[model samples]
Target: MKYPALLPFSELVNQLDQFDSIIDVRSPAEFALDHIPGAINCPVLNDLERIRVGTMYKQVNAFEAKKVGAALVAKNIALHIEEQFLQYPREWKPLIYCWRGGNRSGSMALILAKIGWPVVQLDGGYKAYRQHINTELSQLIGQFQYRVVCGTTGSGKSRLLQALHTQGAQVLDLEKLAEHRGSVLGDLPSTAQPSQKAFESAIWLTLRKFDSSKVVYIESESKKVGNLRVPDHLISCMRNSACISLQLPINLRVALLMQDYAYFISQPNELMKRLHYLTPLHGKEKIRHWQNLSEQDLLHDLVQELIEVHYDPSYLRSIERNFPQLGGMPTIHLNGIAELDFLQLAERLLAE
Candidate 1:
């Protein structure tokens, strides 16, 4: 029997509820890199199996490789049927996809169809969805109004964004999406950032949910946030957007950093290692001094020096060079880093 009909990715996205679930049939590694949102991985061939089959195909021929792959695929399908799909009612419908509308998804769709349950394969598969995201992201970014929160490091802009988000204001928390604070030492300890494509997918998901008529509060970020590069069009739009400068006392900023980087207080060695990235920029003497401060538990002093010497100067140069609109922007002076202060600041920014 013929497999279920192919549904274009565009159509599937619009009528997402038509299917009870979306299943990704790519290898685990491929899904780990990125997959359609809400799709569960039901890989027909696992990572090692895929690699083995691919090597066989290259060394032998397509027929020989398929002979081996077909048995594995059949075994996996039986497992999926018993373990995953047995609970489904006869009326259950699922959307299936693989790389480029290929055989893996087709095989699953075909079996489900033969079993008298309706299913559909995504036309052009994951590739089409990615292309759609690439196109839609550019268009969607242009539709919204952005209010850039401009500040030097540790000015509580991220905290303020969180406050804004909590209060029902539209916010694009890039740092949250990127999983990095957008600095040399931005990488969170023991955390790996998403792949660039995965990062874009996350941004696309977030941007699509925002209403175009309302303002989107976003932090002022450099082009590259840790390992991921912000899309070119987004960087252009953000730089051209209106800005709200956040000004806070250095002491308050230091307090904020101490809290934010509190993990480093216990892990002095890790903190010093991160600081080593600055050796070339700050020179050995300055680096050694900062390391000494960290080792001696003089965190407050270390943070103050880093801010005054490093982050402040870099922030000034970046805003002046990239965000020309920030020159005469209205400044919001923050007196405290208390929870109440942040809530009030968010309310005030929204009111403005």
Candidate 2:
């Protein structure tokens, strides 16, 4: 094969494993929004430089912008070669892309090719890949049979998914992918959610790896998880699919929630701040009461009240409205929230 061969989106998807590295040459800001899975950013023009070049292109002339862009691209590529790419053997193959199959990626591909490394440049670049994902997700989401796990808050839906996954079941834990537990207090301390595009990319990648003939277990999530919106087609498919209702005793549910949200207990002030978001719905007085529970270290009482007052009602309403099929679904009742309990439940589910 010729060095620096240009491959279209179709070929690039099939031949992904052939490349040693997937390098994204767009600005870091653009890369952060979304890139091909496993692709590393090695921007030819960084965020600020990209802005400067784009401003020049609009304010000055194409010729002038190209001159400045060329210089910036050349310098950045040189630095990357020195700092990052110097250790690669001659056999190292890389797939490179930019916003479009344009100069930024082209310049890097040309340099790497000149150095005798095999390179594949993605034609139509990240834009084409994005389009491919959109098309694939639209079609692929409907191919598999989804088993939506329905439960009230603190009912161990996510834990059930984890257990199912351990038992070799296909499970799409959207909350895990989104890094949020899908509630007002769902935010994880010291962890941030991925961008919407990144979240969708994660969903796309996971779906691509599944066997379409097998049933995929998933949680009954809303259209949004944390700040990220689940793709419309995926959410739609899940809503229309079969459901498995998960239930635990209220005591167990509270214990599970307390375990899952231990960070809040340790940091009562943060818990108070999160409870404040409920003010509009519960009124300031009710929210203040919950906050007082947090301050008084009445976490068990607080969790139980939150479940009864906020989560259960909201979840029941959402599930009833969104998942009509849940009217006659199989319900799995658990006595305890132990690992062995979930594992046994997962085995029974799979056996059925």
Candidate 3:
């Protein structure tokens, strides 16, 4: 009278906060493209085997697939368990999932259970987790207090957000959202951004962790940053929300941007399109100097030219239009030493 230890996805999620290991048994490829925030991949079928079995199942029949797949699964399971999961303590509770919590994850868990490891397979697998996360996300965006950060390009906006986060502020980096760094030179060295819907979902999930009655600090962003668009309601909240402005000197702004964006120095042509956003401000010569820079000498020259011609003017315009002398308190400015001051400032603002 042996049966699988079955559990619903909701119960699994409720149990998720307690489990140390959330193991995905649904092939490495499936795990890589996107996965639950902290889940680890230990597939019972590698990508090639999964594809082979899938083709056999579709092109022939389930019997053919099952016959061939069983041997492959058994081999992979032995390799994965021996090389990977065996190191965990016996008390370690692992949540296992496959494409549908069918044979793949169930078989792995059964084997683990025999080894005296406590393992439970997700009832409906990753699709269930995706649904659960989305449901949580949809509920969050409406209720959170979004205090958006409004500033121009090269404003040290993301750095300030990170510093504020270090001081225990609830902050969201939208550049991290679109996976594009929100500029022409924004592509990461070796990472692809998430799908648009998933990006929104992650932002919503992060925001939900904060107190709704209090503010959630986020960077100012347009509706579109590369391929991702901020959800309309959330964007509206950001635009209308009362915000704190962080103003830095043009030299400091340019220097911070140069340091943060290593790719621009390495790939000068990649930054040409950003010049269009600046052309209305800097005229064409500054843009041309930027265009000409490839070596360290030209890059340094372009950096200086950009501050005088582009970033400074943009910063001033944004400040004048959005945050021009608020009624209650003057906007705070802390030069090179002032970022720490904002932690106290953020706490005080939250207290109000």
Candidate 4:
């Protein structure tokens, strides 16, 4: 019986530097939560069969376990190969992996290789890949000099991050996924928020793009923002990051908020709709007070006040609670407005 060469996880990652497709043959539920960068889900066994086979293997011998398990694996791969992998060129080289690079991945690799498609089996499988990834991430996140932009409501952290990106600086915009601004009005500006698993996956993907040797600008945030909570992996990274506070005048912040939140101007109904999210923190009376104000700017002002009172304090408390003092957090004061545009801010930061 001829079998393909089994690759060590480190070698697989190095190969990932060259190959486009690295597949995880685990159940969708497992793959959905966390997966190797760019790997797609093509399960050899669904959740139920996986559980059944594990139970059988524990109770009986390998012969009986293989009897039932082999059938399911063969059927699943046949269906997937016909539907998914059959389109590949005969020369296509794809690496396959499972939990241990054990029976499941071995079976798939041998079949694919016999069909004349080049196959690589990840030795020790997805577990090895995950161990490598987690270790690498922990080291990279700590080693990098991260710049956290801290500010009050409407202080333009998101815009500043965008501006930094335009200027060719590395920046991570957490609000982009949370779809909320981390304040009472946080939910007002967007409708699409990813699940917690998706949120970490996105963050991990973005961080993986840049060189860990340099600085990446990110917004200061609490642990839980919107419906998605920041994963412990990211929380650990942010805890030790170098932070800089972006201070702007409340009036300017209010103006910028109105501008950034132009969608709010279009939907007056949203003013009340999103206001409900903060009802638990702030009662209806304070909300109505802002509503009663004649000027929209006054309403914006009230919104800012509500943020400083409720959101900012909580954020700062978390900061204090998490780290008594953030080491190497250099403070850059933005008292008067910046003379340079977003591009210029990026230039200045990159030069720093």
Best by TM-score: 2
Can you give the lDDT of residue 9 in candidate 1? 80
Off by over 4 Å in 4: 1-3, 48-65, 174-209, 223-242, 255-302, 312-340
Each model's total of backbone clashes: 0, 0, 0, 0
Give the deviation of candidate 4 from the true structure as CA RMSD. Answer: 4.9
- Model 1, global lDDT: 0.89
lDDT by candidate, in order shown = 0.89, 0.91, 0.71, 0.72
User: Which segments of candidate 1 are over 4 A away from where they belong?
Assistant: 1-3
Off by over 4 Å in 2: none
Rank candidates by lDDT, best first.
2, 1, 4, 3
Candidate 4 local Cα displacement, residue 25, angstroms: 1.4
* lDDT, residue 334, candidate 2: 92
Model 2 per-residue lDDT tens digits across residues 71-189: 99999999999999999999999999998857888899999999999888999999999889888887988899999899999999999999999999999999999999999999999
Q: What local lDDT does model 2 show for residue 37?
A: 93
- State the displacement of the C-alpha of residue 330, model 1, in Å, after optimal TM-score superposition: 1.2
Residues 1-352, model 4: lDDT tens digits:
2347687877665467565468789988778666776788888999999888888889987789888999999999999899988789987878888887478888888899899877888899878866776667555555567677776666667777888887777877888866677665567454656666566656766777788777788887777787788766667777676676666777777667667667766766776666656667678887666565523556576657755666567766776776545534655545434435545665777787
* Model 3 stretches with alpha carbons more than 4 Å out: 1-4, 177-179, 195-201, 266-289, 293-296, 304-330, 337-352
Candidate 2 global CA lDDT score: 0.91
> Tens digit of lDDT per residue, candidate 3, span 21-96?
8888888778766676678888888899999999999999999999999999899889987898778888877778
For each candidate, give its TM-score against the true structure. 0.96, 0.97, 0.81, 0.74
**Span of 10 residues, lowest total lDDT, candidate 3:** 322-331
Question: What TM-score would candidate 2 get against the native?
Answer: 0.97
Residue 222's lDDT within candidate 4 is: 72
